[model samples]
Target: MSAPTAQRSVLPPRPSYAAVLRVPHARRAFTAALTARLSYGTVSLALLLSVTRATGSYAVSGTVLSLFGAASVLLMPVRASLIDRHGPRRALPPMATLYGALLCLLAALTWRPGAPAALLATAAALAGAFTPPMGPTMRALWSELVHDRALLQRAYSLDGVAEELLYVSGPALIGVLAGLAPPACGLLLSALLIVAGACAFVTSPVMPGPRPAQAPHKRSVRPSGIPGLLAPVAVAGGVGLALSGLDLLVMAFTAQHAYDTALVPWILGALSAGSAVGGLLNGALPWRMPARTRLCCFAAALGLVIATTALAPDLWTLTAAMTLAGAFIAPALTTAYLLADELAPTDARTRAGAWVNAAVNAGSSTGALLTGLLIGAVPLGICFLLSGGVAVGTALVAGPRRRRYADRS
Candidate 1:
């Protein structure tokens, strides 16, 4: 009996990005959820394209998409709050089911003529309102499954990589499907993918349940009340603003220019391809600076790369600059997410993530509108320069405060 000593429980070594799939239902759930996410860039674009065919007006289609985005942004925090309160098991399935059904309905309605624009907008709003809170759920799962900071960052990086890849694949898939048949066909497929994904995620046992903090910790934890949270949220918005501005600039360039009418995609693809590579490499690395430091460094590097894009006079130069600039985007965002996770109270995880998302949406919407207004009037290069300046300015202001926030923690 004396010889029998207790052996401490050591978690099987931290799972690498590849190994993350080995967790129970992780492969199935992640793959399914990915399909659901694929619907993201598809449905809205598909609707836009389909409606344009019907009414021959980009403005109407644009209005619908804008309204959907606004509706989604408004609902993210609310949906996340519900998930946090009720736990995913009880909450996610109903929302996903409703969302998928609404999308299917939207696709069906698009086939008919004389469907009022208001009715279409209402359907989109409903779909957006019910869209499943998958991103935050995935992040919360990673946080729960991987306790070590190093491994967790890897997880976030990997997640970031998937998101970048989606930028390519989502639109490509939608384009292909639409080209093959009706644009509504692409939306139909998107709905199916989302429904299938919802089924997979809802049934997954790996989902972390509601974790009510201990009494003492609960009293002390108020993630929104924390000192440094707003800074990262603001930076997230800035990132969105810059990216959207760049998007509009590319759109304007492609629309007006005859040589490469389709160049916008290639440009955006380069940006995403670079981001994918950066995210993977960043995750694979064993050594990393602190999240706050990484955030500032990545932001500054992004600033430099984006600023250089202003010098691009041709497609090659623009592509090269975009590729280089895009690399820093994912890494900076990864750091911001990690910081949010760190600073937020355990109970507030989903809502905190939602806030980050909302910031991005807000920034993207505002930036796109502003850039659209300015694109024809200004030298196109000025857009890149201004976006880069924003990034650089954000970094400079955040750097010292980042250190202070860490110290306070």
Candidate 2:
């Protein structure tokens, strides 16, 4: 009898790490990153201005933001599913167009004071539902473009830093525009930028095509569900809660003291600035350390910094504490993303990433509400301490489990 033919390896040839870094696709990915930053900034600024102007209530603004977040969390998976089925090029443009149009309509509807809460809620929901899946789609495209895993890691680090910049500049620009012109003006401008950014990214030549159809045997090579996906999701959710608590603490302190509402902006700016610094450092740091160890250390540091915020004698001290807390944000977040990527089944990468996002938003919403309730019942310092403690505890619990799972897998 003839010997069986030798089986061929199915894996694609791995590219050199340096080649991936220098590729045109990496450059194009960076452009898309910039566009995402600008679009987020515009939308955030408009939201803050619109809610505040219409309701004259910070509580209303917070509620609206929370609702938008919840909506985004619920809808992200749907958008990711579309990308997995249709490719980034087909999925992005329509989502962006719908989102932008909704924002414009929202601005028009909220132009007058005393706009109906239902109308505002409907507009916010629509905007959230249609928001482009830029982050996930872009990451998927980056994986396809940069052939080296190391280069992909660097790309993610840079993207994280860009996100920090968006938070810093986006709201500040909206505030300035609203003050100079009107709230509606900022919303209109945001819509224009969203359309522009989405169009630029969708038309980019480097975007990946839809996955090809294959026989059942060929398709069986997809990634299987990792044994411990739950741990990372838990960690992400905990971190989200911590962030929400911090936000509430800042808001409550500012409101009670009647200091420049501008302090809120400055505090957020400090946090974003610190996060950007962390992202830059992430690329330079030695990657030999275990991901879990680094994440635990970062989370512990964040908790300590947050707890110290209670000791601040003035806004300056509080800002300093916040900056320190922010320094850990990117490191821990990067760890989570790396873990998620490692744990994801090949066919479910986008969905896995979206799940992480959803966990975060859900945690944040929970934390915000929890902190809000405690503001009247407890000392502000105590609230911060409790929130920080929760974060530290969560990291201790989840970090080790994540490592064990990855090691086994």
Q: Compare the candidates by TM-score and give the number of the best one.
A: 1
Clash count of each predicted structure: 0, 1
Query: What's the lDDT for all of these models?
Result: 0.75, 0.72
Q: In candidate 1, how many clashes are counted?
A: 0
TM-score of every candidate: 0.88, 0.81
lDDT of 1 by residue, 4-75 (tens): 332333435544887766655667777867777777767767878776765567777788788878888878
Q: What is the C-alpha RMSD of each candidate to the true structure, in Å?
A: 5.2, 8.1
lDDT of 2 by residue, 118-210 (tens): 778778888888877676666666666654555666666766677667766787787778778878777788788778877888777787666
Best by lDDT: 1
Candidate 1 TM-score over all chains jointly? 0.88
Query: Distance (Å) between predicted and true CA of 393, model 1?
Result: 2.2
